[model samples]
Target: MKRIAALFPGQASQYKGMGRDFYLQYQSVRDIFNRASEVIDKDVYSICQDEKMLQRTEYAQIGIMVLCIAIFDVVKREIESPIQFFAGHSIGEYAALTCSECLNFEDAVKLVQIRGTVMGKFGGEGKFAMANMGSASNDVIMEECIRFSDDIDFVSLSCDNSKEQKIVAGSSKAVKRLVEGTEDLFHGKVINNLGAFHTNYMLEAQKEFNETLCHAKFHEMKKVVFSNVTGRPYFDETQVYPLLGRQMVKTVKWRQTMDYLKKMNIDEYWEVGPGCVLTNILKREDPSINVKSADKILKMEGTGNEKIC
Candidate 1:
């Protein structure tokens, strides 16, 4: 028996027509889009199909969530293997929670809608931006960030995607200054966005999101779920809400989460959302690990046994 871990993709993974194939083939997937539309009061299917509408942060977040869950639903119907662990990146975490039965689909949809609205509103108030630092060690990035913090308004390490790929977020001026000063050390590129997420810059958004989470109900996890903030499996239901609140203003410990999963001796890994972002990260981390995308798995001749890793 193989122990399977499912990874969900977050923001930056959305693309036009992400779930169109799944939506057309499965009524269950179409029903998910319908429910999402009713809850968010937006035609999610149309938004996902249109490249322009999918670019807006608020719309993109909800659209990604709907598509992720829909893809997971279709995969679940086809595969009977029991998932040993569920984890997602950023917004994808809600989909993991839904998979673990920690949150209902309707509630998850509404919460993400509120989360997207709050983040979009508060995120654009400043000249915030995010940048990816390639071919750099975590310690080096952290050291540079700290060194520049004395002069920069807000400079902090955001996502530790892998050993060689890290992200930084802060005010645009601060990020630009840091990048210019350290240009010789590593390859860097600024991501297009208004808000610096997973840093103190999102304090206001975190507070507002906490209020919304207070009303949201969470159930006991049916399967082990890892936290992007803590990079560990949640011990109990009590840790869910607070960790999620803090996740908005904390660095995503993705590399650490991957390390933890490897330590657990997980036999197989599955990327259950749009794009191959998480899957590619996992492959780079360890080529020997067995991994596959659910979308490709669905297209195979029979219950797909081929592994991409």
Candidate 2:
């Protein structure tokens, strides 16, 4: 069996009718959605089909994860290859942990619901915000953020998507100024829908969600998984609670995560999610690395879904 590294994507990659293919073709996909629906007390399958509802944080977080997990189940059914490692961007980590058996599917869904609800309550109506800036190096983004920060207003890097793309979050005024000042240098835009995640702007959310993460039962990983906070393999199950809690209020080391995977003897990299965000990031970092997406997974040799909706 070829050694494989599986990566799951986080929020913002979701779209209308993302996982309808899996739901229409596989019983296991519907089963996963039904299981998740019981935890959140809402119809997950129906939520995926609604574009306006999917934009909300509460629905988007859980909906994206459930779809990702459903696709992962399909991948496992079709391929028997060994997974060398597992990791996710942000909310994607819960999917990684659930697939690796660190946390059960129901528990992962519950945590995401609570996480989304807590964070969603804040940073709305222009109290705070996040922005994406492209064509600027990570150092330049950080340097500029520092230059814009002050006691009353500040901005911090939330995600290091790649060397050229970085995201910032903080007081609305600060983020606006940062984007406006750097617009001439890079493509910058304010994110109005989602809250400021992966920054101290989420401190309250982190505190509220920490209790749930600690309360959730975690088990020994059946496969190795990397940390978005540390950019290294999780030492063991003991680190899951603290690391996941800290992830809420820290920069996601995505660039570092790709660096760590390079050392491992990975034969194939598969992105099992609705969108190809992770796949695109890997290609940008190293075009030579062989990678595939769920769409291609459905067409793998000797694989076919018998049942159709």
Task: List per-candidate RMSD values in Å.
Answer: 2.8, 2.9
lDDT of 1 by residue, 1-309 (tens): 678888999888888878777777779989999998998788989988888877667788888888888888766655568887988999999999988889999999999998888888777735788888886887788888877775447678899988877999988877887888899987688876657888887899889888989888889877999999998999978889989989989999988999999989998888987789988898987788898886433445585543222
Model 1 TM-score is 0.92
Residue runs of model 1 more than 4 Å from their true location after superposition: 150-152, 296-309
What TM-score does each of the candidates earn? 0.92, 0.91
lDDT of all predictions: 0.83, 0.83
* After superposition, candidate 2 runs with Cα above 4 Å error: 125-127, 135-139, 183-193, 295-309
| Model 2: worst 10 consecutive residues (lDDT sum) | 300-309
State each candidate's clash count: 0, 0
Q: Clashing pairs in model 1? A: none
